[model samples]
Target chain A: MPDKRCTEDEVVAELADGMTIGIGGWGSRRKPMSLVRAVARSSLRDLEVVSYGGPDVGLLCATGKVRRVVYAFCSLDSIALEPHFRRARQDGTVETFELDEGMMLLGLQAAAWRVPFLPTRVGLGSDVLEHQRDRIRTVRSPYDDGEELVAVPALPLDVALVHLHRADAAGNGQYLNVDPYFDDLFCRAAARTFLSVERVCPTEELASNGPLQSMLISRLWVDGVVEAPFGAHFTECVPDYPRDEEFQRAYAAAARDDEAWAAWRARYLDCGGHDAYRDAAGLR
Target chain B: MSGPAASVGPGPATRADHCVVALAECFRGDGEILANPIGTVPMIAGRLARASFEPDLVMTDGEARLVAGPVPVGVEAPDVIVEAWNPYRTMFDVVWSGRRHVVMGASQLDPFGNHNFAFIGDRRRPRAQLLGFRGAPGNTVNHATTYWVPDHSPRVFVPAVDVVCGIGTDRARALGPSGRFFELRAVVTNLGVLDTSGPDGRLRLRAVHPGVAPEDVQAATGFLLPMVDDLEVTRPPSAAERVLLARIDPLGLREREVRTS
Candidate 1:
């Protein structure tokens, strides 16, 4: 069986400065942390990160690698707000393109389907349209004289990084968690996709497992595959492992305190590869 | 179960318990709707509602999985049977279809139920940037929305929300048929429960929590709350309901959020 398996660093090497990157996962769940760590370690600058918003957003913001962020919401889930992201917003360190969650999905969907825009009823009467006037447009519905809807434009990405439960070396991926999230759309919307999975089993093993619905991203959409067990640590990746709560607490706590963050990063993030960090953090 | 401090009576119940019970009551007649409780306290209420009377109500484990039983907050909940995969995208499908009933926090809420969580002050250069209109805008127009305010203060129950995230009664009425399904169901706070059941569709004092005076609620609210001649006290959790609350929240996280003080 032909394998496209490379490394986390090789996945990061495909990315460049000032490119739009989409990250897969709901807030704080199934994030490609190993790849994100790789990006953070590299001196990539001015990257525009598109995510449902999790620690990926927080890490990029803390590292000052992000020039702009296009997101619906950014949080540490249980923590509600990502402290670093919040600090970035308060200080105006990064430009933001905040959309309604639905609109954000539509933007990705539009890109995935090769459409210029997608009509939505989401931000019709809210301040979202007021704030994001440059990006969103309103057009009269073709069916009726006075009916109107918001037109959310496509958010094409230079690269998309995703983490899933299992995949084959061919880049065929499956999500064991309840929701596949927008991982499929993220892959389709991007020019290239790099997937990091917990395990790379035989193709037949994945095929025999069960429901076809669980197989989210097909090999065609993926440009590369890396097997990174515990890739989404500190974030929940169900059926494999829950989030590392103790580590998450430390991360969030460090994010709030400058000196604490410096020391913590020195130990985990600044050490070496994901292995060194995982070892220091005592991750199995 | 071991605590002699815990009791069955409404008087003995803590303020957080009252809030959990009151928040849970919002789903009483909802009948098989998606109960999306956003925050910690609200999650407790949603799960308590499911495990108790509203058994048919669908609930996510708050991360992703739609579980058969209400999993305790912040726990892995291993071996729990997953009913369905209601991910972020599918969640929007439920929202757009007006099937989800959400209980989320509000930075400010007007008398007509216009809520804000976006920002304060001017739109362009906000004095403070809160969570940008995440889903509140779509949520308000699409389905039943109940708000929770842990602390009742004039700043929160504002005369006018600087930014409109959720569709208030005033705005919904102006939209006519398009906003027909919009329902600002209830406003549950630490103080009491409020609703827009009055003739004018302004927030009315539905029920006060035990030991909370009607005047205290009024003083805290920025707008006038139409009071009934005889205000009812929010019902406390039953003995069985308390048992389920304990099971649903083994760590007593709800108590920390609601606060007995």
Candidate 2:
């Protein structure tokens, strides 16, 4: 029988320590906060995560769930520029490989295509790509007059865990937002993809619009789907829902001191497991 | 009529005054404020942090693919908008999707109004080899493009470019609305402002901020700069704009100050 869709608890239990994981969503939009909270409570630790700019990586660091990360930038858009990522880099708590916001998609695509590298001429003079020669290698291009070029290798993911607006029990899901291509490419390249959705609606009822309908994901690539409501709050953004600026302001204010961190750690980070955190996130 | 691109003669006091005055105009009712990209980190996040014209939930660029950015504060996160280069069919989607706003930087811009993505040379090849025109042609026609010439140099504002990677008024006019529309909005330079209108491809001087002079703009430009009527000095940041700006970007981006060379 095809594997039954497991609860958030079972999913967290399956995640072992030190695995490379990919979290879903944009800056504050579409984050798998429930699953992230669930992962925080588990005994497993030090899982390296690969993600673009967002609070998910910060959440992972705040909980001590991440050991290292391969990312471009992480911050709260201005509230408090990602203090966790900044502090980690400054203190050497975690190793980081920064890329540009533009090159983010290509890197994942490179991984998904299973190609060794993808060539582009993005950061030639800028300091953004200066130190990242390891991740980005300079090579000559055939298109140019033997001019130097750069190649960014594919970033294949082990498990792609993305939060969605709706899904069916079978994992045939569709994202309500206009964009699905961001995580869509990664899902194809990853070994297994996990989808944590807000509502599990019937496939036929996904959407009536043609553009939105074309972007839906079939059940073949999705390994599991977790039903999560209000899960994208704080980390993931819902268009009409409004971002929690108050909480972000509070987090920025509190991040200034060790005492504050301790309080935060005790209150939020140190969950016994998924069930407790789920209850906190109002997930029943 | 001197023509839109021709010298109408006013510094910041006049022509560019419209754009300047219009800055706070969009925000009249409730008032919409578009944060300017001034400093580094703060500049990067300015669009999201601004109280005016704030995103209801936050959105990524392009009408097609919502390349997720970090979900805005406190609100529930959307799928998250992240930028990508060749996100497979993403570029194709953006280009094909009718009208879209894109901001990109240019190193060299010529007199004929053509932009150089390939190495800059005159009739043939007379200059150093730069990053050859990468995606200019496709993007310029495909989207409502804006060329952000960060380092405003004479070489950049040239009479003609070596390689024709991106489209200019000539190209856009040829392509019509099916192609690119807004020829040039504001050439936000370190010195002053350069905006154009007429079909002759003439560039007029719009503004010379507080310290900037018409001479400086002329000396720095690669082509003949035009003049506008009744120009005033480009006003410095207001108390409110400055305070919020500092709060957002504590670390100064690129140059140290708002006023640059």
| Chain B TM-score of every predicted model | 0.94, 0.64
In model 2, which regions exceed 4 Å deviation?
Answer: A1-3, A78-80, A142-148, A204-215, A236-240, A271-284, B1-208, B211-261
In order, the Cα lDDT scores of the candidates are 0.85, 0.55
Clashes of 2: 74
Model 1 alpha-carbon drift over 4 Å, by segment: A1-3, A144-146, B1-5, B9-14, B47-55, B68-82, B119-130, B197-200, B223-230, B237-253
Error of 1 at A108 (Å): 0.9
* lDDT accuracy of residue B31 in candidate 1: 83
Taking chain A by itself, what TM-score does each prediction score? Answer: 0.97, 0.86
TM-score of each: 0.89, 0.58
For candidate 2, lDDT tens digit of each residue in B34-90? 222222322333333333344422224323333433223222435655543333245
DockQ of candidate model 1: 0.50
The interface RMSD values of the models, given in order, are 2.0, 13.4
